[model samples]
Target: MNSIGVVYNNNHELHDYILKGFPSPESPARLKRILQHFVDNRVLENNNCKVLYPANVSVEDILRVHTADYFSFVQSRSLSGGGWLGNDTYLCEGSFEVLLQAVGSVLEAGKAVVTGQCDHAFALIRPPGHHACADKHSGFCIFNNAAVLARHLQHVYSCQKIAIVNIDAHASDGTQNIFYADPSVLCISVHQDPSDFYPFKGFIREMGSMPALGYTVNMEMPQEAGNPEYSIFFEEVGLKVLEQFCPDLVILECGFDSYYKEKLAKLNLTVDGYYDSVSRLRSRWHTIVLLEGGYHDDLGLLADVVLQALADNRYTKDEVNQVNLLASRQSSCRRIFDNKLNELKKLMSSYWEI
Candidate 1:
């Protein structure tokens, strides 16, 4: 497996708003350091090679999935030193370039997989995009990176069918909103339920609208839903949907927010869960992995574990502690899993054969 990690943001420093004077939670410098740790550990640097692309996502590329007016608005704000288009998002002077680079990196990832330059690739981008919709931007996302890559494959490469799977704890609201009306791209989000979460949207009942009904699948995992449920969803329902959709290529909106260590969302996915999910996808479709959101101290560590799975096509020796992870399997988690899987089948069955 030849996987590449592309980055655009040199995340400069910012003061933390909630901390009301402290440093920002997300720093490009920190992201760089985290990526470096992955390289140093031989998780990435010792294995598949990497390629860097310039931070320039064309306006036309932006217009493919986003509104021309919204593109103009984000660009205009980017000119004046960007900051907070909404919660958890900010526009630094370099944010415009950073965001473009992020999209460019994802586009490059798609190119690698589709062209067979590599068996798989990961775009280690910043300014998370899953939250940004077609006309609005929020939740630290200005533009949807996964959506960008999907459109790149569908339009430029002539992929007739595409499947986008988001594993972020928060719903892939932006990606979902963009393709909600398009039947060609299948958008499936596995995230924390909207009962009380940021950008509250992904619900079991919220399938796609008319003309594109059943194309949008939202598997809203209850808070603290862990590896078992994730695996079941992928093996039983999720992958089956992919088979039914018959995508030419797969674009993964891979987010680490579901990691037990992450503070952004309450899902309890361990590093092992991340590995298993990627490994499953590796077997089925040509995958383009784009980072979405994961605000935890161990972003680098978790990222390394995820790459291990993608490269090896199996779970690496359990590096992260698995104590609590096992406990989830022993608890009432199975009941929850059964219930969620049953609900998911009910929603996806109408569209998928299984």
Candidate 2:
């Protein structure tokens, strides 16, 4: 079994939205429940998993992806009694510290993997960062965690090629935009169709620009699309691109919102699907999994599945019936998914072997 390193903010509640008298899906309860489930199940005790606490990252690290003005704005707002920062994102008095901790934990996870301290690492962090861009925050994200980690790997660890695969229900627009024109980093986001969703920007045609034409890939899953669709997409398109790019490290922007139980989004990835996705990636490359967005109660269960996949262990069993879950979706979901898959393949053929 592979040893896994787990890192999370023990004081994540410091950035609580409830303390600000605002009720939001992105709350401290998300991480609270996940940590509780981990403790109750002894997820860390088995599988040779080590829990790690991270220190705050420096301002220099933050500036690697975000502009100075944006960083200052967040710090200032956080100090002056935090409030809304536009794009449905909010900041609390302790949000800045929380953001630093989140980024720091992610970096520590990456360090654990790159240095061979562990085979893989999972940063069970909050206030999802994939939506935050270089100059703006969106979708409750304040810092682009994956982007910062990618940059850190390149500059600090001398990793030349990095691939970021996002399975969040919503597209990873911020991470995509940050490395849109850079060829060193390949970004692949498989999410619910952005047409009728929040942050409606991750379409198949939004490939990268200039020198990195085919670096950015977006697979739009139709509503009700579930395990089969995700499995096929990864097998046919996602894995093929990864093979071509041959990244030194693969960062998985894992979000449980794609699960069938999520109310904020409509994707049907059950425990088994999540396992298969991570297993396929971990089978080939060193991976660093970063928690993105998911407000459901099943976060703990799914997090277990991720750890199991990383360790190549089969301790967790899927309680949900996959057959019935798939059957509940409209038949047209497959047809729409097939069409989108074809379109993506055709567009990608120019850049990759797929």
Candidate 3:
């Protein structure tokens, strides 16, 4: 199968807002250079990789994960102006165009995987979406890209089972809220504990509600959580849980903020950790990766790491102080983690065999 497929819009630049005389942190070009790297490396030449774009996402698609009123509110907000949707989100006059392209790319990305066009696809667009809830926009997100694609797959192609894996340093609160009561979509987020993060949500105990109790899973790592911690969770828990769910497809909320260089949140995931995780999941199901968050100046380099991991089972490890990081974490981190796991088991038992 062709290893890589892309969904992008050149006009995505239309969403580039120059409000405060600075580029938005969530820009469309974040992954563009990395895509080119694959080309320079001959990783994409003659491979049939593609850039698929659809026009603005249909209103029906938008409403699948958002209330009409909220949708209209954002439409109007686009006209007047947009600002911090919440702690990390920002919106401006051009946000609508950006938002549309974001959703459109996501839709096309999922379509490529579901339709057997690619073993994996990446939707590289901006204004990251995991933080955008059905009712509101926040955390630099506008349309909840991953959520929309999950629903679209279900509605368009009869994909009844879908899994969304969010690895941003911040929890996917908006995604959890959207799928809280739905059984068909399983949302798993691994992020720094919300106790000291932006959204201040994604606690372990906040599993899904009745009928979907166990579908939403969260792992809250302590600040400065590093590669070893992330890999252990995936090996011991993430793989175990996902193997049991057996979704028809996997949608990754692929955000790079967990890197050590990122200032937005404290987590230390080197490229080796990333490569191993994706490699483990590579054969399970087709994957559609949506770029969600990551604002470091080295965004392109990290993006290349992700593509390498996904396409060739290869990644360049970053130099890290593993010994120091492990020793420096809170003495209570493990204790807190165990308690969180117990709470999650108790909460999810009603709907799943936790």
Best by lDDT: 2
lDDT on C-alpha atoms for all candidate structures: 0.76, 0.93, 0.77
Candidate 3's C-alpha runs over 4 A off are 20-24, 27-43, 46-48, 54-56, 80-87, 315-318, 321-354
Clashes of each: 4, 0, 1
RMSD of each: 2.8, 0.8, 2.8
After superposing candidate 1 on the true structure, give the runs of residues whose Cα lies further than 4 Å from its correct spot.
Answer: 1-24, 313-316, 319-333
Q: How high is the lDDT of residue 103 in model 3?
A: 89
For candidate 3, give the lDDT.
0.77
TM-scores for all predictions: 0.90, 0.99, 0.88
The residue-by-residue lDDT of candidate 2 on 251-274, one tens digit each, is: 999999999999999899989999
How far in Å is the alpha carbon of 315 misplaced in model 1? Answer: 7.9
> Deviation in angstroms for 71 in model 1?
1.3
Q: How accurate is candidate 2 locally (lDDT)?
A: 0.93
Candidate 2 pairs with clashing backbones: none
Per-residue lDDT of model 3, residues 1-354, tens digit only: 347776765555555545634446666566566566556665444344666775468999999998999888888887777655555556677778777777888888888788887788878777788988898878777789899899999999999899999998889999999999998899999999998787899988888887887888898887676677777777666767788899998998888889888888888776666666666676677778788788776666666666665676453666656777668777777676666656665665565554
Return the clash pairs for model 3, or none: 89-140
- Choose 2 or 3, whichever is better by TM-score: 2
lDDT of 1 by residue, 119-173 (tens): 7777887767898888888877788888877887878889898899999888888
